[model samples]
Target: MAFIPLSVPNMAEKEQEYVLDAVSTGWVSSVGPYVERFEKGIASYINTPNAVACQSGTAGLHLSLIALGAEAGDLIMVPTLTFIAAVNPVRYISADPVFLDCDDSLCIDPKKLRSFCEECCYIKDGALFHKDTDRRIPVLVVVHVFGNMADMPEILKIAEEFHFKVLEDATEALGTKYLEGPLNGCMAGTMGHLGVYSFNGNKIITTGGGGMVVSQNAELLQKIKYLSTQAKNDELYFIHHEIGYNYRMTNVQAAIGVAQLERLETFIATKKENYKLYKELLEDIPNISIMPVVEGVRSNYWMYSVCFENSKVRDDAIKELDKDKIQTRPVWGLIHEQNPYINNITHNLEKANFYGSRILNIPCSSGLTIDDVKTVSASMHKLQL
Candidate 1:
């Protein structure tokens, strides 16, 4: 039997038409109409003043840090349970990442974050510096894990007190929104000083591989765009005033993104419907629990994640799912324990460590039909017997 993949992009016929037009126009390189249109569409969708498209989510993070002046020896706070790409950008800038724990929602725990910052940092020369590393903690990369919104209100308040720049990683949360408070109805990427989105193949939408950085600050957005395009000065050719990166997305990719963006709302709706079906079907299972949307937040349900009682049960379920030709994956390893960041400082990761082992991602592609969901649920139900 063929395996049902965990995730797949939903590319309608319109997406193919856009790419074909771009190819026929011979504007398949980095500079083209599709790139501009995609940037504007993304900025408009997220309600941001401007957006800068880049080659990948990692590149977008790197550019955001560079624009915010995150540098060597600066400490950045990141969640321990996120994908490595979210944390690896800190290393790209030669900055140290201090991993924070997650809450029941699998998002960064604001309580632990504040406590850690308060205990580990002190004001020196009017700047916040870590007590042990003596490095300035300049930025906080808050990830919206698996399309669920983090506690932005509390996190933003802490960022204000500590004077750290906030970079919202909405890479997995394209259509997620907070439903209450100051950020009421605001999209995930719009709540921070700067935000990034991913358009990778497995995301809600795809540009084959592309990302965007958005911010209300026009100057910062311009700087990010400039840095992404190798910091080229319009007045002078090959003029180098600053170190930059070649991270601009090709026009071919942006063409696909433009078409994909057009269908984002439809895809989000499909994902939510599938999630509801899964929840209804799995509600009676004792050892299985589906992730919940916070009372005041709306998730895109980018990946429908389920948690078993423990790692042993989760492992058994994985094997069973595979035997039935259904694809499933475990959550990311705790970033603090990873080889690259093992030496970094970490706060209490009790929840993150626990969830990391027990959690498994099921098939959540926008293309999954109602029958596919029923099939998956039936397979899972059989596991209980």
Candidate 2:
């Protein structure tokens, strides 16, 4: 039997046609019609006024910080349970990151966030500064982990009071939406000051590898586009005002993105359908817990994950699955525990630490068939024995 991948890109003949068109037109570089079309499609889907295409999700996060004026020595708050891409941008700007804990849904806990601010930070010259580092804490990069929505109502309220910019790291949640409360009917990326989406090979969609940053602030979005494209003044011959980066996505990649976005809704529906089947199949397992979609929120179910009772059980199950030629992956190790970020400030991460050990991502590609789901489910059920 062929090994099932944990996640894989779903591309069809349409993607090939788009790539061929771009190649035939001889517009395979950055500046092309496909790039503009891709950016516009993303902006419309997210209900944002402006969107800027970039090379990757990391570029989007880094550009957001630069556009928001997050300078060196500044502090940014991020969830510790998220992929390192969400937190590395803070380091890119030479800014400090205070790792916050996750709640039941594996998102940044707003209550704990407020507690940390009130307890460990002090008001210096009317700015909230960390008491120990004395760095001005400026932004919160709220990641919607695995397509689950964070408690944005409480998070936005805290941001208003604390005066920190909110950058929604919706890299894994392109089609997710808040179905109730203040953010009801709002898309994941549009609810924050600036939002980012990733189109990596393993994401719900793929542009081969690309990302987009959207903002309600048109000027800021334009600035991000300028900075992404080496900050060159279009009118001048070779005039460059400030330091810039070559982070723009190529037309070939954008061509792929355009085709992928057209089928995003279908991909989202398939993922949700697969999650339901997984739940129904694994419902009887005693030691395993499937991730829950919080009430009134529609999750894309980007990567279907299960948590064993403990690390030992989770490890044992993984070994068993490997013997059966089934692919499985453990969740990210806590970022603060990593060698690079071991010295960073970390708040109480009881839930994050607990889940970090137990959670394992299973094969959840959009291309998965019912048989694939059944095979994986059978492997999971056998572990309960």
Candidate 3:
């Protein structure tokens, strides 16, 4: 039997036609019609007014920091349990990152965030400042972990109370949305001041490698576009404006993205179905349980993760599954524990540590079959016995 892989791209022949069109037209470079079409395609799908394409999610996040006016010595609040890419952008602009804890949703804990704001931070002239590090807290970077959105209502409330900007790293949550709330019908990344989405090979959608930045401010997006394309104010005489980056998404990548975006809804539906199949088959397994999204949040279920009794059981399960050609993985190591961010501030990390050590992701590709889920579930149960 072929290996039941973990999350991987499910590209159909649709991508080939688009790529062929781009190549045939000889518009495979930084500037092309496909780039504009891809940006508009994503913006229309996500219900955002404007979107800017970039080379990668990290680049998009870094551009968002620029859009928010992040500077040296600024503090950005981030969750400790997210992928490292989400936090790395904070350092790119020379801003400090202070780690926050995650709640049951596996997103930032709003209660802890509020407590930290009230107890450890202070307001000066309508801006927040961290007391311990004495850094100006200007922005809060929120990641929608595995397509499950953070509790934006409470998080936004805290941001309002503390006077900071919200920049969402919705790289994992392009199709997820709030079913009911003040943010009802609002897509992830759209609620924040500026948000980013990734189209990596393993993402719900793929552009080979690319990202999109969405915002309501048209001029800010224009500035980001200019900055992405080397900040060229004039093309004829090579007039350079400010510092910039070659972060624009290539036309070939955008062409692929346009095809992927067309099938995103179908991919999300398949993911949800497979997750349900796994839950039904494994619900009775001992020492194991599947992770679930909070009520009213329609998760894309990008990667179906499980929780073992402890770290040893999780690791052992992964090893056992790998022996049978089934791919599985443990969750990311906590960002706070990573080498570079040790000196940064960390709030009450009880839940983040708890989930960090126990959570393990299973095979959840859009291409996964019901029988494949059954195979994984049976393997997990055998481990329990």
Candidate 4:
């Protein structure tokens, strides 16, 4: 059998057709019809008033911060359990990040967030300010980890009480949504003040490398679009009033994104079905269990994670899987632990520390077959002996 891979792009549909169309039309740069098409498709899917296409998820996040008026001395709240991209944008604006812990859902813990605000921060002139640094804590970046919806309602409540903004990093949760409660029918990205999605090769869908930003505020979305395209005050005379970035998504990428958007639901369905199959196959096995998505949410199930009894067991499983030609990996190192962020202040990260070592992500690509899943499970079962 061929080597099974980790998550990868499922380009079995109209990807080639759209790419060729984009190439033939000579509108392969940022300015093209396909870009608008992709933006509209995403806005419609997310039920947002507007969306702006950007070079990557990181770029979308950076643009979101700038549009939200994040400044050099501002403080942004983020989860330590998330990818570094989610935290890097805070530094991009010269703002410091106050890392927070994650709950069982592997999303930011609202309790800790609220506690930090109430215990370590104070309200001044209707804005939240950290007591130690006196920096205004203006935004909270929430990541819906592994397609699992974060505890948004609770987090939103905290943000409201603290007078801070919410930025949803739905890069890994494009199709995830709430199934019930006050946020019923709300998709991951649309619930926050601003949200971003990625179309990287390994994501559920792909545009090679691209991202989209959505917001309820159409005016902000327009400003983000202008900022993404160099913020030209006068296009004809090449006059620019403010600093901007060349972060616009190219037409070729947008073309691919438009095609990928056509089949997102299909891709998510495959992911869920495969996740179910893996759970069933490994249910009776000891020493490991499939991590469950939090209740009241329908996750895209982009990555299938297995939690081992301990870090040693998880590492052994990873090595054994590699020898069996099945790719696997551990969860990301906590952002607060990373070298660049070693000095950043962090709230209680007890749960983040607990799961960081024992969790291993198995292959869960949309293109993976039943036989592949069975092989992975059967191989993992052998490790018990």
Question: Which one is best on lDDT?
Answer: 4
Off by over 4 Å in 1: none
lDDT of 2 by residue, 65-121 (tens): 999889998989999999999999999999978899999889999989999988988
lDDT of 3 by residue, 265-366 (tens): 999999999999999998998777898887898888898889888999888888998988899989999999999999888988899999999999999888
Per-candidate TM-scores read: 0.98, 0.98, 0.98, 0.98
Candidate 2 vs 4: which has more TM-score: 4
**Candidate 1, residue 230: lDDT:** 77
Winning candidate number (TM-score): 4
lDDT of 1 by residue, 226-298 (tens): 8988787753668868887999999999999999999999999999999999999999999889999877888
Alpha-carbon RMSD, each predicted model: 1.1, 1.2, 1.1, 0.9
**lDDT of the candidates, in the order given:** 0.90, 0.90, 0.90, 0.91
Give the poorly placed runs of model 2, Cα more than 4 Å off.
124-126
- Model 3: which ten-residue window has the lowest total lDDT? 376-385
Tens digit of per-residue lDDT, candidate 4, span 1-385: 6799999888854878888898998999998999999999999998887789999999999999988878998989999998899999999999999999988888988889888999999999999999998889989999999999999889888888889999999999999999999999899999888999999899988899989999999888988989998999999999999999999999999998899899999989988999999999999988888999989889999999898899999999999989899999899998999999999998877999999998999999999999999999988988852
Candidate 2 TM-score over all chains jointly: 0.98
lDDT of 4 at 214: 95
Q: Runs in model 3 with CA error above 4 Å?
A: none
